[model samples]
Target chain A: MHRDGRAFAHKSSSQQELPMSRAYNFAAGPAALPEPVLRQVQAELLEWDGVRASVAEISHRSPEFMRVATEAEADLRRLLSIPGDYAVLFLSGGATTQQALVALNFAAPGQVADYVVSGHWGKVAIKQAKDYVRANVAASGEAGGFRDIPQAAEWKLSKDAAYVHMTANETIHGVEFRPEWGALPETGDVPLVADFSSSIASEPLDVSRYGVVYAGAQKNLGPVGVTVVIVRRDLLERAGQPRADIFNYASHANAGSMLNTPPSFNWYLAGLVFKWMLAEGGVEEFARRSAEKARLLYAAIDGSDGFYRNEVAPGVRSRMNVPFFLRDDALTAAFLAGAKDAGLLALKGHRVLGGIRASLYNAMPVDGVRALADFMQDFRKRHG
Target chain B: MHRDGRAFAHKSSSQQELPMSRAYNFAAGPAALPEPVLRQVQAELLEWDGVRASVAEISHRSPEFMRVATEAEADLRRLLSIPGDYAVLFLSGGATTQQALVALNFAAPGQVADYVVSGHWGKVAIKQAKDYVRANVAASGEAGGFRDIPQAAEWKLSKDAAYVHMTANETIHGVEFRPEWGALPETGDVPLVADFSSSIASEPLDVSRYGVVYAGAQKNLGPVGVTVVIVRRDLLERAGQPRADIFNYASHANAGSMLNTPPSFNWYLAGLVFKWMLAEGGVEEFARRSAEKARLLYAAIDGSDGFYRNEVAPGVRSRMNVPFFLRDDALTAAFLAGAKDAGLLALKGHRVLGGIRASLYNAMPVDGVRALADFMQDFRKRHG
Candidate 1:
C-alpha cells in the first residue's frame, strides 16, 4: 500500500534522508510524526499548492492560508464526527492555555469548577484554574499514587459547578480513562471538559458527550503551537467576563481563530496530519493498532519475571503512554544507553517520573512496539 | 556567496518549486521570510542534526530540541545585543496577548497604564488593556487620520502610571515612531513597554532603553506561533497578581518559556532566521537594505505625478509599511490584478484602509522592490 513504505521511500530522496537504521522515537510528544505526514510537510515546505512562498511566509489573512485553515477544520470535524453545534477552534498557546481559558470562560465569579485529579496534568489544570475560579477537586487518584482512575461512584459532584474537568490520559503516570462515555458520573447540566492532549484521535470519540474536548497538537495530532478546542457552540455564550481577545473563546470563534494571525505553518502541517489520518482509515484503525501495540508491550513486561514492572492498574493502563521501570535503579543509564544504541530513542520517562516511558501515539507503528518488546526480552536476558 | 543562489537552487529540487517567475510577497505579516532561511528549513524539515524525526516531532524536553531552543535564544540575544538584565522569552499567542499581559502584569488594581494611540494597533492595545487596567491614552493621532506620529512634547505623562505603552510601527496605518530613543517623552521611573511587532530587528536596538520589547515572529522574525519578549528582569518582581501560568511573563521567563511545552517548531525556525540575519551581517545590514527597499518603493509612488499618492507626512513615513493609493479608486481591482500578473503579490491594503500597502520588511530583497517599482510605473503609464 502507498501508506506503508512509499512515504519512507520518498524521504530517502531528500537531502536529509533517514539514516540506515531509523530510530523509533517514543518521546511523549512533541513526539513521533507519521512518516507520510512528515514527508508531505517536507515536500510542501518550500511552496505549498503552487504558491511561490512557503506556507509559513504567507499572510494568515491571504486566501491561500484561509483555505488551508478552512480545509483543516473541515477534515477535523469529519474525522471526529463533530456535530454542527460544535465550534472547532485552531488556536495557539497549547492545552495549558486552554486550561486557563476553560476556567476563565466558563466559571463565573464565586462559582466552583470541579476537577478530577488523576495525575500531574490534572493538578496543573487545577492550579491554573484557581487563579480564575474556585477549583474544586471532586475526585483525586493522588492518594493512590495516580495508578488508576478513581471510581465514578466516588466522585463528589458539585450542584453549582460550572464544569467538570478531567484529563483523559495522564502521560507521566500512564493512566487513562477507559473509552466508555457512559462511565462518567452524571453532573446534570454541568458541562464536562476533558484534556485529551495525550490521547486525542487514538480512538473513535463521541463528540456529543463532552462540552469541550481540547488537545495540544504536539502529541497524537501534529507539532506544537497549534491547539485544537472543540467546544459546544452554546457554551461560548456563557464565557465569563470581557478578557483579552486572544483569551476569549467567543471572539476567537467569531474570527474563525483568526483574531490575531494564527500559527499558519503549524495549522497547515496539522491539516496534512488530518488528511493522513483520514487516508489511513481514520480513528478506528488507530484504536485497533494502539490496543495491539499496548498489549504486546505489556505482555513483554509481564513475561519478564519481575525484571520489568509497570505500576498502573492493568484496567486503566494507557495505550498511548507505557511507563515502566527496571528492577535495578542503578542500571538506568545502561538501559537508556542500550536502548539508544539499538535505534530506540527518547524512551526515558519525564523528569518528574524517573523511569522509562515509551509513548505509543497513533503515529507509532506496530513494528516499533514489536522492536521495543524484543529489545526488552534481550535486555532482560543479558542484565538478569 | 553561498547565501545567494544556493538557497534558491536547492528549493527548485523539491517537488513544490517556485515558478519560473517568483512573486515578491508584500503582505504586512505573516510576511516574507529570507529565501535562504526557508530553504534551510525545507532541507532540514524531516531530519535535523542527524535526528530521524523532524525538529517539530522531537520532544521539547529532548536534548536535541533543547539545544535548538538554547541556540535560538543565544543567536537572538547576539543579534539584538540583549543585556544581561533582560530575560528573553519565546512565547505563543502573539503580540495581542502581550497587550493584555503588559496591563495585567504591570498594573495593579486602580493603577494606570499609559498608552500612546498612534494607529490601529495602538487602539487595539488600549482596548485589550482596558479589561485589565486603567488604559490611559496619553496621546493619539486619530485626529490627524494617523498620518504621522503624535509629537512627544504634547504627550501627557502620568505621575503614578504602572507603565507607558506604544506601538513602534503600525502595520495598518503605515505610521512609525521616529528611530530616536531620546524623542520619547520621559516617564521618570515608569517602564516603557513598546509593541515592536512590525519594526523589531529592522534596526539595531538598545535593549536597555525599554522595560519590555515584544514582537510576533510572523513579521520580520520568522513564521507565526513564537513571540519574542525581551523584558527587564526587574519588571518580573512587579508582575501584579497571580494569573494563568501561560499568561504570566514572569512564569514564562522563569521556565525559559518551556512552561507547558512551548511551540518548539516555531522556536527552532525563528532560530534559523536569527542565524540567517547574523550570517547576512545582523540588524545593521537589515536596516541598510530596508532603507534602500523602502526608498525605491516610496520614490516610485512620488514620481507617479498624482497617479500614486501616500498620505503620511514625509518626515515620519514608515520604512517598513508603505501604504499608498491610486488617484482613481475605481481602478483598484485592475491595479491589483495587474500587480499579481506582474509577480507582485499581497499588495492590496488592509480592508479597513482600502488602498495598496507595499510592506518592505527585512527579508524583501532590493531586486524585489525594484521589480515592484517597475511594475508600478508601468501600471501608471497604462492606466493614466
Candidate 2:
C-alpha cells in the first residue's frame, strides 16, 4: 500500500513528491495538498494535456482551453453524477463571493432567507447575506461550542423564505451533518443552497436534493482561483434583480459562464482532479477510504481517554477535519516539533479552535492517518 | 536567437505542455503570452518561487502566497509608477464588472455621468450605466467609423457630471488615446475613470490623470480570475455606498481587496508577471519595443497601399492590436493557411472585422512581428 512510504495516487496527491511536505503547510484554508497531485500538476504545468504553454499561460478563448473547461465540467458532472437540469459555472471569488451572489440572485431587500449557523462559514454566510436580503438565522449550534450540528427538527425555518442556506461541512470546526439529516424546512419551493467548500467529493452526495451547490476549488477539487457552482436551471429564472452583472446567476448561466474570462489553467487542473476522482472509482471509493482514515484518527483520540480528546460527538464528527486537544497545553510546542520531525505535515489545530486539527479530505490516505495515530500513540506514551 | 529551432522546451522535459497552442496565440483578449514567461511557469508549476506546491496550490492565507500578492501589487505600482495616494486592488471579474461597479458605487440615480464611446468597452459602460444613472455619450468616435478617438474638446459634458468615463484602449477596434489628448469640456470637477483593459502596463501612464484606473489581469498582467483596480483614496470616499460589500469600490479599499478570497492564484501570477515586467525595465521598455513592432507591421500595410490596408486613421492607431486587410478578400483563406504553416498561429482577424489582426502586446517578441511583416511582404509580392 505504501510505495516508497508515499500515499499511492489512489488517494489525494495535491503535491509533487518532494523530500518533505513543503514547509508543512497547515496554514489552513490552503493547507496541505496531496504530493502526487502536485507532481502531476508540476509535470503538466507547462504543457497541459500536451498543449504548449502552461495551461495558465494560454488564452481561455483558445480551442484547447475551451476543451479543458468543457471536459472539466463534464468530468465533474460525471464524478458527482450531476443531473441534466443542473448548470455548472466555474467562477472566481471563492465561497465568500458565492455567499453574496446567492442572496443577490435569490432574495432582494425585504425578502427573507434562512440560514443554519454552525461555524465560521455559516456565520460568514449570514454576514454576507445582509448585503441584499433579510437573512434569518433559522438555527444555531454555537451555544453548544459548535461540537455538533443542530438537529433538523430544532430549526425555526421561515415559511416565506426565498432559500435555505447551510454549510455542509465547517472547516474551522470539525462538525458535520450527515446526508440523512434531510430537513427541508422552507415553504413555497425554496431552493437549497449548500456551501460544500471543504467537503465536496469526499463521499456520495445526493445532487438531486440540492438546488444550488458551490465549492471553491482549493480544498478538495483542485487549486485556487477556480470555484465550481452547480445550480438548477429553474432557479436561474426567478433569481432576484437589480442583479449585479458579475454575481448575477442568470447572466452567468446565459453566457455559459464566460461573461468574463474564466481562469483557464485553474479550470484545467480541476478537470484533472475530477478525472482522477473518477479513475479512483468515484465517491463510494472516496467514502470507504475517507471513513477508514477518520476511524483511525478518532480511535486514537477516543482511546487516549484523559490524554487527548475530540469534542465533536462521534455521530456528527467530520470525516475531513478532525480537531482534538491534548490534556496538557504546555506540551503543544514539543508535540508539534516531534510531529514535524516525523514528516507528517500540517498537523496543527485552527486558531479559532484551540485544539489541534488534522484535515483529512478526499486526498488523505489511510496510511497518513495511520502514521498520525501512531505518532499520537507514541507522544502520549512518552509524556502521559 | 533561435535556441532550439523547432521545439521550444523538450517533449521529454520535466513538465508536459498543452498541445492546442502548437502555434503562437494572437487572440485579442487572451492573446500571445511571452514564451519565456510561459516556460518559467512550466518549470515552476510544481513549485513556485521555491515554495512547495504550485503557486496555484498554495493557500492565499499562507505567508508564502501573501508575499507573492504583496510583491505583485508593489511591482504593478512600480511599473506604473503609481502614486502613494492610490490603492491597488486585485479583484475578480473583468472590465465588464468594472463598468457596473464604477457607476453603482460612485453615482446616484440621475446623476449625469459623461462617457466617451471610443469602442466596445465604452459602449458596455454606457449600457450598464443607463440602468442606474443619467449616462450620456458626451463624445463618440463611432461616426469616424470607430477608427480613432475624438478630441476631448468636442465632448458635450454636463457641468455637474458625476464622472467622465473613457476607454483608454479599445481592443476590438484597434484604437488608443494618448493622455496628451487631455483637454476637458465643461464637466465641472468630475473624476476621470479610464478603462485601460487592453493598453495597461504596455506604456507609461500618468497615474494622477485618472481617478480610477481599472484593467482585468488577462491581457497584459496575468490569467483570468484577477482584475487590477487602481483608485485614488479620495475618490473611494465619494462613493454612494461604502458598506455595499461585493462590488463597491469603497469596501474593497477598506478591506484591502481581501473582501473575498481574492483569486489567490491569479493574483500570484499577476505578481509573477509584474516582477517579469520590472526585470525587463518596466513599461518604458515595453512601450519602446511595442512601437517598433507596430511600426514594422504598419509599414508593410502602408508600403502595400492598394495591396494591404488598415482602416484605422494613421496617427491614432493602437500600438498593440493591429487589424489590417488584404486587397483580395478571396485570398483570405490562402493568407491564413500560409501564416499557420509558417508557425504564425491565430492570425485570423476578429470575427466582426474580417481579414488579419496581429495583436502585438508586451509579450510578443519583435521577431514574431518581423516574421509576420516579412510574410506579408512576400505574400503581397506574389499576389498583388
Candidate 3:
C-alpha cells in the first residue's frame, strides 16, 4: 500500500466495481444518490480541495466554505431558472420546521392562512402553523382517502388570507397535481406557498407561479440536514408576527443564510448533487427520465390483471412515488423478502399505508425501475 | 485494484501517510476533528456496515439507521454520565435556535428570564429569547470588555424568573468560570440553562448541575447541523407558551428526536466521534489534555514579555479558546500569514475580536498545542 497525493485516485480505481453490492434502493426521502456524486464525496471526504481538512471540520465563514455556499446557490438558481427577485436560503432543520416558520414569517398573529390539504403531509403543515395562524382548510381530498387532489375551483380561499399553502406532491398517498389536471388557482394577490419536499428538481418548474417554494434536501436535492427555501423578495417587507430573529426568513435572506453557522457539510454535499444534476442536463433530463421510469412501473402494475393494484387516480398519480398493493395481503411480506433477495431493497410499504412503494427519484436510474418491474412480474407469476 | 468488501481496508492502508497535508486547524466552532474519525468516515462514505447504500442515502427510520441513532444516544449518555431523570434530544439547527426554544418551552409569555452576559454569544442568546420572554440582564462583564466572568455573588436573582441563563465558556472573548471563581449562584426552583456550545465534553460535567444544557455539535461533539440538548425530565411539563410542536422540547424527547426527519448523516458522524472519545478514555482524558494544551499556549503568550498579550483575567481564562493580540496591531496580518505558511491554520481572530485566536477543543491534541507554542516563540523572535 502506497501513501501519496494520489491516494484518492488509487482508492477510486480500487473501488470501481464494488458498486455491484449496491441494491436498487427505493427508500423514500434519503433515497438513492447519483453514483458519481457519492464517489466524488468519498474521494474528497478526507482532504477537500487541497485544504488538508475534511469540509465538515472547517469554519462556515472561511473563504473555502464561502465559495461553496455561493456556488451552490448559483447552481440551484440556474437549474431551477429562479428569478433575480427571489431570495434563496440554505437552512438547518427539515421541511416541518419551515412549515411553522412560514406562518410566523408571513402572517400577522392569528391571521387567516388558506390551506389545500391533499394528504398526510398537508395535514401536518396545518398542525405546525395552527398556533400562529388561523389555518383554514379551504379544500381537502382526505374524505376520498387522498386518492386525488381536490379541484382548485372548489377551494374557498379567504379574501384577506396571509397566503395560500398546498403540498406539490403527496409522498405517502402517491398523489400529485399533474399538468393534465389543469392550472393551479390564481390567488390574485395572496402568494401561493407549496411544499415540494418529495418532488423538487424532478421536472422543470415555473418559479414565478408560487410566492414561496420550500423543499427538504433529503429527497431529490441531496442530504437530510439542509432545507432550501426560495421566497419572493417582496415578502421581506411583511410585518410578520413576533418571532425570534433565527426564525425570521428575512433575517436569513439579509445575512445570506449565514445568520448563524449553517449545516456546512450538508450544504456542500447538496452542492455536489446540484453539480451532478446540471451535468446530467438539469431538470429537463430528469423530467424525461422520470416519465419513463414512472411509466414502466405503473404499466407493470396496471397490466397485472388484478394481481397488483395502485389506488391513486391515474391522472393525479405521483411520478416520484408509485405505491401499489398485491392481490393478497398475506403475500406482502413474502414479496418484500423476495424483492430484497433480488437486490431490490426497501420495498416494504410505510406503516401509514400497507402496500409496497417504489420511489423513483432523480437518482434512481431507469434500469433500477425496470429491474423492479421485472421482479414484480416474476413474483406475480409464482403467486398466480 | 480490487473491488472486494475490503475496499475500506485497502483505502486506509494506502492513505496511511497523507496526514502530512493536514495543518493544525484553530478555527472556533466548526473546528478540527480526530484524524482517525475522518479516515473512518472517508472509508465508509460509499458503503457502510455491509449496507448497500451510504448511511446518508438511507431512510432514517430504517432498521440500519435506527440502530445508528440508538447507539449514538447511548454512547452520548455514557460519555456524559447523564442521569435517568434527564431527557436528551439530538435536534437540528444550532444552539442559537435552542436559545429561542428554551424560552418558549420554559417561560411564560412576557415572563422574566435572567441572563449573565459574558461575551458575544451571551448577548445573542438574549436577542433570540427577548421576544418570548422578558430577558433581563442580571449580570454582565461587558463593562470590563468581557475579560472576566461576573462574580456569582453580585447577581440579582429574579424572584419569578423562568430560568437563569449563562454561557459556560465564551469562545470569542476567551472567558470562562474556573473553579477558583467560586460556585455558580443557587437559583433554587428556577432551573439554570446553559449554552455549552464551545466547551461541552472538554471535561466531566455534572448532569444535575443545571436545568437544561444545550450545545451545537459543530464544536466539541461531532459536526455541524445538529445540536444536543439535555434537560431535566420534570421540566418537560412546563406549559411555557404557544409554539409549534416542532419547537417543543418535550415532543422531541417523546419521539426520540425523530419528530421530523433528523440530520441523520450528522448524527452518525457524532456517534463516530462519541465512540472515538470513549476509546480515547472519555472526558477524563480530554480534560487532562485540555488543561495541558491551555497551559502550554497561555504560557507562550505570558512569557512573550508584551510581544503577545491576552487580557482576560487569569482566574477566568478559557481553556478552549485563547484570543490574544500582538503588541503592534500592524503585525497582526503578517503574524497570521506566517502561521498559515508554517502549517498552522485559521489563527485569524473572529471579526468581533479581530486579533488572533487559537481554539483548543477536545479534538486538538497536546502535540498540536506544543507546535503552536513553538510557532508563537518563532514569530515573536522575528517580529519583536
True contacts kept of each: 0.55, 0.35, 0.61
What are the lDDT figures for the candidates, one per model? 0.85, 0.75, 0.89
DockQ value of candidate 3 = 0.42
A314-378, model 2: which lDDT tens digit per residue? Answer: 66788888888989988877788798777555666777877687887765667768888999999
What is the full ranking by TM-score, best candidate first?
Answer: 3, 1, 2
lDDT of 2 by residue, B1-384 (tens): 001122212233323432344455556766555555555555566555545445665556666677677777778889999999999988877778788788877787668898999887788888766766789888998887789778866778878888999988888788888544555444446889999888899989988878889998778775666888999888877746322466677777877787767677667667767876777778999988888988898898898867988988766788878888888899988999898767676677877788988887776777778888888888887888
Better of 2 and 3 by lDDT: 3
Which candidate should be chosen as best, given TM-score against the real structure? 3
How good is model 2 by TM-score? 0.91
Clashing pairs in 3: none
Ranking by lDDT: 3, 1, 2
Q: Candidate 1 lDDT, tens digit per residue, B167-222?
A: 99889899887753237876779999999999899999988889999999888897
Q: Mark the 10 consecutive residues where model 2 chain A has the least summed lDDT.
A: A1-10
In what order do the candidates fall by DockQ, top score first?
Answer: 3, 1, 2
* 2 against 3, candidate with superior DockQ: 3
Off by over 4 Å in 3: A1-20, B1-20
Q: Say which candidate scores most in DockQ.
A: 3
Interface RMSD of 2: 12.7
Compute the interface RMSD for each candidate structure: 11.4, 12.7, 8.3
Better structure of 1 and 3 per lDDT: 3
